[model samples]
Target: MRQIRRLLLLISAVWAAAPLWAEGERAGDFDYYVLSLSWSPTWCALEGDARHSPQCDASEDFGWVLHGLWPQDEDGGYPSYCRTPKRDPSRAETAAMADIMGTDGAAWYQWKKHGRCSGLSAGTYLGAARLAYGAVKRPEVFRKLPREVTLPASVVEQAFLKANPKMTPDMITVTCKAGRIQEARICLTRKLELRDCGAGVDRDCTLEDALLEPIR
Candidate 1:
């Protein structure tokens, strides 16, 4: 009984001291942030079964969803899992950001894969992600993609730039998967201001024009 009590006490002490995402040597070692906003329809169609998100339920009028806030280096590289412990966000911890991140699997995977490297606790990282996602004003045309509306990358870029006066062409890049518009990735400084990502990061949407399949 004495040994068991001592072990339980030790476990509690370690958890309290370990801090959420700031434990390891690699924490806080990043350059910039990429706030990726995914079109809910695209995600529902593509990775629906894999992620099993609430957005796939088709109950609400879902538009763009927060994919992740990823930390990146100047060279277009990123670190994952870093030196953080296996700290997962509890239900209360994810409440504020769950609306955009999708309450199910998205939040958990993102925290483990990307947020762990941001040098913040799960709550802090999730709160920051919500802020980053809210910073950009999504264009109406993209809020609900027009039926059978296929457009060029430049057109989409222009719409966003016009919507967000502070956002620039170099700072936001449209991403596509299998010729379908997927996400809009915007580069931001550590302070959450728009910034150019430079030539190191290749824009994922290479096609001249991509199809925007309307959300079903």
Candidate 2:
């Protein structure tokens, strides 16, 4: 009886850990999407400039750039690097995304990490990503700033909410990194419709005065 009970307990333990072990094993098995729009100037100030990335070049004039379209689980976990039989995108295909993504490399990386989990082919995923990026209305107000400023992170969220009437407070979040405004993450359905964020993605930055750099 004791040996049988031990075997039962071992089985239960493995079952409980199944989700973690099987993460990214299946494709297209997510609840929703999180569209991350990164503040370009802030990224330059933090990391881009250091790397001498061309996205930070003064002539680039980038504002909010498409960071990634991540598939999320309602339970706050996300799948990534899932196994897929799709062919990788070509150099031209990734380069085309540079206008919105800032670099072909970023586009390729997003595909490798999050896009594979979407169960879509590389071309289809990139096309979906472009459509999703176009769906969001990036507020022109931020780009009009002639100089850097510091404001509550909530202000960024409000700007998005105002520009996109279909989006509510619960549907978007402002995140900060190294005391600078990082990204505005918006929740969306698989079809790209606005939706409330899940618990993990709902974490809004509490910075009362986060730095926002102007477009260079």
Predicted structure with the largest lDDT when compared to the true one: 2
Task: Put down candidate 1 lDDT per residue, 3-118, tens digits, no spaces.
Answer: 99999999999999875653334866889899888877777778874776667776756677898998888876787877765466996676656688766467888887788888
- Candidate 1 stretches with Cα past 4 Å from truth are 1-25, 49-52, 85-87, 144-146, 199-204
TM-score: which candidate is best? 2
Per-model RMSD to reference: 5.9, 7.2
lDDT of 1: 0.78
What tens-digit string does per-residue lDDT give for candidate 2 at 115-137?
88998988888998899999999
Scored against the true structure, residue 65 in model 2 reaches a CA lDDT of 98
Q: By summed lDDT, which 10 consecutive residues of candidate 1 come out lowest?
A: 19-28
Cα error, candidate 1, residue 3 (Å): 31
Clashes by residue pair, model 1: none
